[model samples]
Target: MNQNTKIYGLVLAGGHSRRMGTDKGLLHYHNKPQREFLYEQLQNICDAVFMSIRPEQQAELPRGFRHIVDENMYRGPLNGLLSAHHSFPEAAWLVVACDLPLVNEKILKYLLERRNKKAMATAFATRKTGLPEPLAAIWEPQGLRQAEIYMKTAASSCPRKFLLNVETTLVHPEDDLWVANANEPEEQQRLLAKLNII
Candidate 1:
């Protein structure tokens, strides 16, 4: 880790979870809330970490750590990214989604190693999945400003739309293990079963 490069960690936990039928971040996958697992893991790789959620759902969220609300009321993952950018304008944030239980310190360190100019974003790019996963990408403080402008002007609130406009470095997907995101209960069960935790 570069001492000069200060990076924060952001856990995107704002999803409505209509599909999961509950707060996805709070669901237990391995005897722990998914968000707590992510938060603990991110703590190993970042200077600071915070959960991004909606203001109305704040009460149902777990305590012990702080959270950032998307006051803009803007929809999509972009709202979480923008909120993190506004809260910590000085540090580059590694924006991760809570559903990605497979994310680890090694992957985060890999991204940090490739971080170059503020204009460049380091992301994972699989031949199967082009561009870094937006929710799993590294965002520089300056990049946050650019994303804000895009969100304000775009008719759609897609994070990918904002990322496409920026300069980025891509890491090809080497293993399927790195990109596993538990979107549904069955997927969550499979991940835990694969890990031999269930």
Candidate 2:
């Protein structure tokens, strides 16, 4: 890890959970809200932690937790990532989506330990599909800058696609469950069952 590039945590919670039919961030998975659980977990390792939310969500968050409202500058998770990047341009960000219930401290630590600063980003890739999981990856300052430029000419708003085309380091986690995302209602139920919460 480069001493100059500090790692800050950003929990992306601003998405419209239409498929889930409820706010995924507010879902109680580990006895607390899923987003808050991830936010607190990141506090243990990151220099600072923040939740990337929408403007309307600002009032919903409890005090003491730092938040950056999505500027809506870009699409998808990239909006939140860039908003945080714009706030602290020099620091690197360890980003996690709110829908991933299995993204615990161990998985986060694993990603951080394997971070390669020379690369644009150090992302977790699924062995099954060999696709990068941008939601649960570290975005270096340079990587974000490239992403910004990539967005300017690219029509696709997919973050994973950006990582796939860039000079990124792919890390395969020991457990694939660590990056499993609960996007729809069925997925939420299935993941909740896996967590023994259902």
Candidate 3:
């Protein structure tokens, strides 16, 4: 990574969680809100940490943590990712979604250790899917700039689609469990059971 560009941590907690039937960020799989757990994990590794949130979500947030409000310029995770990029254009954002209940501090440290600054972004990809997990990656400023361009196209708004065609470095974890997402209620329950939380 370039010395000029510091790595910052971003917790993606702006989703509506319509399918989960409640706020996913508030889920307590590890005795703390999932987003707070991620923020604290990132704080342990990155130069700084901030939570990406929707404008209305701010009031419900606990104090002391830094946050970047969504610009709402794009849909999906791109909105939070791009919003963080806009807030700190010079920093590389190590982003993690709030819906991921199994991701822990160790996995985040692993990602940082293997980051390729030369690549557009250094992302986690699973062997089973062979696809880049954009939300669980370090997005370089240049790559994020390209993502902004990619979003301009009417056909492509998804971050995974953008990363698939870009110069992102994919690092595979020992197992895919660390990157598992708990989007729907059932998925959350399954992950909770896996973690012995439920």
**Highest-scoring model, lDDT:** 2
Model 3, 1-198: lDDT tens digits are 466789999999999999999999998998989999999999889999999999998998899989999999998889999999998888999999998888889999999999998889999999899899999999998998888988888496788988889898998989998899898988988888999866
Which tens-of-lDDT digit does each residue in 113-168 have in candidate 1? 77654454667665676856777778877777777887778898877767777887
| Residue ranges of candidate 1 with Cα displaced over 4 Å | 1-5
Q: Is candidate 1 or candidate 3 better by lDDT?
A: 3
TM-score of each: 0.87, 0.97, 0.97
lDDT for position 37 in model 2: 98
Predicted structure 1, TM vs. truth: 0.87
Error of 3 at 164 (Å): 0.7
State each model's CA lDDT, in order: 0.76, 0.92, 0.91
Clashes of each: 0, 0, 0
For model 3, the run of ten residues with the poorest summed lDDT: 1-10
Candidates sorted on lDDT, descending? 2, 3, 1
Q: Quick one: RMSD of model 1?
A: 2.6
Every candidate's CA RMSD: 2.6, 1.2, 1.1
The lowest-lDDT stretch of 10 consecutive residues in candidate 2 is 1-10
Q: What tens digits encode model 2's per-residue C-alpha lDDT throughout 55-87? A: 999998999999999999898889999999999
User: In model 3, how large is the Cα lDDT of residue 174?
Assistant: 90
